[model samples]
Target: MISLARKSILHEWRRFAPAIFAIAFSGILLVIQAALAVGIFSTVAVYIEKSDAELWVGFPGTPSIDQGRYIPNRVESFVRMHPDVARTEPFSWAGGVWRSRPGMGDVSVVLAGIDSRPGSLTFAHAVTPVLRARLAMPGAVLVDIADRDKLGVGIGSSAEINGRKVHVVGFTQGLRGMGSVNIISSLATARYLDPGLQSADEVAYYLVKLRPGADAAKVQQALSPKGSNIRYEAWTAKDFASRTTHYWLFESGMGTAFGLSSLIAVCVAIVITSQTLMAAVAASIREFATLRALGAPTSHLRGVVLQQALWVGVAGLVIAGILSALVLWLAKLAHIPIALSVPVTAGCAFLVLCVAVLSGIAALSQLSKADPAALLR
Candidate 1:
């Protein structure tokens, strides 16, 4: 059967070539779009990902780090008292108008307030001591590298955040927000800048570090209060990361957009593949009819058609993988975070093969309608 399929592919290489390329292109599209979608989710939860805490305590109604509701600052002290909890710190989150430079009018910015303490964040990337020290200055804020243009600010440049003057003392990479800039400053600065700021006793969240050898689940159970009215919950870092991702991905329409784009790519592959295979079948209908008239078994006839499709699918996957790698390399050069992990790559290959098989089946259905007897006449 394998030999039969190989010969068939070789016989129709020209006709199959376009279909193979189309399927490969479609596979590449899926890989890129999926990587982008995952990247968006990763970016949306950058702070949570970077935090050194083992657990996060947020108001009950809050779905993620950025969507935090105001909670009493005293909660940090209370959380720190837990035997399993090693430390607790207050984080202040707010959105405000940013006026950082010329020609770049007011822009919405997400600001975070944290204590100028070491080991405060467990960044996927490293942070320097100098950058942390600079954040200790009054009215100092750290900005995203990309926001240099968006907020029109540079190192040592000043900006107005929530009507209070602030200096961009440093910058962090890969900290972009969804259509907003991120600025981190001291707790005092955040409170001074925002008129609607909560009392110092209140905070947007409590970052919790666990003791070594502590059971997170046990600690979470101990810390998580009962009753639906209680407005606080403890979430492990991974849970919090997933929660934040879910909020932006599904609740915020990012998931829908990416899903539709992927669906379109698959649909395109199927449509083009089906048409190409059907055309190949049509051109060879007489030959197939001749074989059938000679008493070729139905299984043999089906195997020949199925083999052609399977072979094309295998070829397409190879081409798609190469194309996807090149695209991913280009994305890295552009500094875009399009992941090409092993699982994602393998999944894409499987999906493209499925599409190819389905396309062959569609063409086979067309061939099934041909009158082998009439052709013999």
Candidate 2:
């Protein structure tokens, strides 16, 4: 029976080609969009994991580390007072522009400032020893590799930030924030670039590394009442990263764009599948009627239509998978955050099959009205 069904599908390839292509194109679009969204979220996760800090202490009501309020430098000292706290470091964040060339113009850049201490865990774990050494120097900055290429700036290059001289000392591979280029430098340098800048009394936040076997929640409670200007929250590195990912996926416009693209892909696939199956059924009405005239069961006719749908689905899935892979590779080359997970790709293929079956079933309604005598005419 399967062999015969295969023969039938082969016989109708000319009629099915356009439909197959349509479905495949739709699937490719959906997969690519999904991969891009997943990639962006994963980048944040990787950044936090690399930092290896146990807890992030930020301002109260701050939605994300990027938007957090400045904490008093005293907060860091206070947090360090806790026995469970192994080390505490102040982190500052700001945005500015760097000249594209000697006098070309200025392009946007994210400025992240951390304390110059070599023992700081956030710095120690996030950067190499050589880079850390370079960062310790005043006026030195680290630029993300992506920004380096985009801005055409190289290590040892000089750029002006808010009219203040800044020198690039090193480069970070994947340091980015909400789609902006990030430059890491000392807290004092960041303040120099923007003097209205508040010091530890107004530092962006504190990154705390806890002692081994210490409870983060207990440590957080112990440090909670130290200052009214600050609120302490404790999160495992993974949890904090997850929260950051969720913030972008759910709260940012990126989520909406991804969802709309996926919806359009699915809708396009459905329309193409439905129309193709309907046309196939209409053209085969005579064949279906002849079978009925020869005592073939309605169930048999249904099975044949369904098998055709399955064939279309399988072919489309293969094509779509290939196209998606090509797009993912291009994204990688372009350095865009786009990832294709095995489970996600597989799940999408399964969904395509289900959609095909449902579309075929809808087309089956035409089969119910076929009359042998009329088909013969």
Candidate 3:
């Protein structure tokens, strides 16, 4: 029976060709979107993890890094007073523009400033070692490698930030914040842009590093009362990173945008598959009727049609999977953040097959209602 199904599929390939192409194209879109969503979320998670802080101290009522207010520098010293708190580092969030040449156009970049303190939980040390070394120098900046082309700047290039000249010391790969290119510099540089900031006062947040086996919750509680105006939240390094990544995935529009695109692709697949399969059924109506007259069961005919759909779906999925991988590879080569896992790609293929099956079933409805005697008339 399976062999017969295969034969039927091959015989009717021409009728199903359009459906195959449509399904394949839809699969490509879905896979690409999924890969990007995963990549962006993973990148954020990794960034937070490498910081290696037990607690993320931010302003109250601001749930995320981007929305929080700068904490005062005094809080850093105050938190360090706790025996559980081994150390605290100041971090600042700022924005600036980068230009390739002295008088060229500028591209906007997100600025992350960290204190010069040794063992600081800084972007430079945590995310990229190369960036850490480069940023250690005074007045030097690190730009996201992906933005180099757009900014028209390279290593040893100068860019104007806040009307002050800053030199691009090096480049960091896979570093971005909410889709913006990230630029890392010292706390002094950040302060220069927005100056006279007190040590604890000018920081966006504090990263609290705890001693080994120390109770992070107890530390948080102890530090919380000391800074009555500020809120202290503590998590294990892993948990904190997970929450941060989830924040961007669900709260930010990236998750919604990707989900909507997937839904659109599935809908398109359904429409295209249904129309193409319908045409195939219509063209082969006489063949089906003759089979029924020749002792072929309705169930058998249904099976044949469904088998054709399944074959088309599988073929389309194979082609789409390969195409999606190629696109993701090209994106990576171009330094874009698009991560594709095998499980995610496989899941997408399964979804495509399900959609194709439904489309084929819809086509079977017309076959079910046909009357063999009517054609004889």
Candidate 4:
């Protein structure tokens, strides 16, 4: 039965080509779009995801970590006083200009102040002693590697941050969030860049390091907004990242746009796969009727149809996979950030199978109408 199905599809080269193309194109488009969307959102909130602390304390009514009001620096002291909280560090976020070179066009940047402690934002424990030592210099900051071209700076190179002369001490990976390239510097440099945060009453975020076995959700609840003159909102690290992701993915309508695109792709696959398979089977209506009139059981006919579906599914996946690779390679060459997770890959495979099976089922109705009388005619 599989051999017959294979021969059938091979015989109708033109019709099969269109069906396969539809499946391949839709699959490739959907997967790439989904991957890019995930990349953008994950890139946007990567800091919240990678922070060494378990909790984040920010001002109330803030939509995202980058847009939050500058809370007083003393909030770190208050948070540290919590028994479960072993330590609190200030994340001094400030807006600044990044000159590409000593004298060139400038771009906006988010400056985050980080300490050279155990939970340093040194790109996942790779911060070298020399880099930390250099960062401690009076006018040193780290830039994200992704922004190396954007900022046109490297270690030992000089650039202006908010008009303040500075040296790039090191680089971190994936720290450049969605909005702008990030310039991570020490607390001193952040204050130097933004004089408004010089007062003890102003800070951006408080990253809370809890004791071993501490309950993160409990700590978050404990720090919830209490209606104080200086309001505060607390979030667990995961929740904090989620909040940012939600804002960009849902509130910003990115998820909706991507989802709609995927839906349209699915629809295209179903329509083309169903119609083409139905027509292919129609071309053999008399042959199918003769088989039914002979000793071949109805189940055998069904198996042949399913086998045809399986052929389309497996071949379509191969074509889609190849096309997807081309798209990914081009994106990489262009320095476009696209991430394809295991789930997305698996989902694409599953969707391909669904396209095959669903089309097979829809064509089942057409196959049922194959008349044994046509064999005599």
Q: Which candidate comes out best when scored by lDDT?
A: 1
Write one digit per residue (lDDT tens) for candidate 1, span 41-62. 7887778777787888989857
Winning candidate number (TM-score): 1
Candidate order by lDDT, decreasing, is 1, 4, 3, 2
Q: In model 2, which residue pairs have backbone atoms overlapping below 3 Å?
A: 72-200, 73-200, 73-201
Candidate 1 vs candidate 3: the lDDT winner is: 1
RMSD of 4: 3.2
Ten residues in sequence with the least summed lDDT for candidate 4:
118-127
Q: What are the lDDT figures for the candidates, one per model?
A: 0.80, 0.75, 0.75, 0.79
RMSD of each: 2.4, 2.8, 3.2, 3.2
Tens digit of per-residue lDDT, candidate 2, span 28-95: 87788788788876665554566757777776655555666666666677678888888776778777
Q: How displaced is residue 377 in candidate 4, in Å?
A: 5.3
Candidate 3 to native Cα RMSD, angstroms: 3.2
Residue-level lDDT tens digits of model 4 in 89-159: 77777888887565568899888777755446423344565666666788898887778888887778988
Q: After superposition, how far is residue 279 of candidate 4 from its true place, in Å?
A: 3.3
In angstroms, give how far residue 131 of model 4 lies from its true place: 2.9
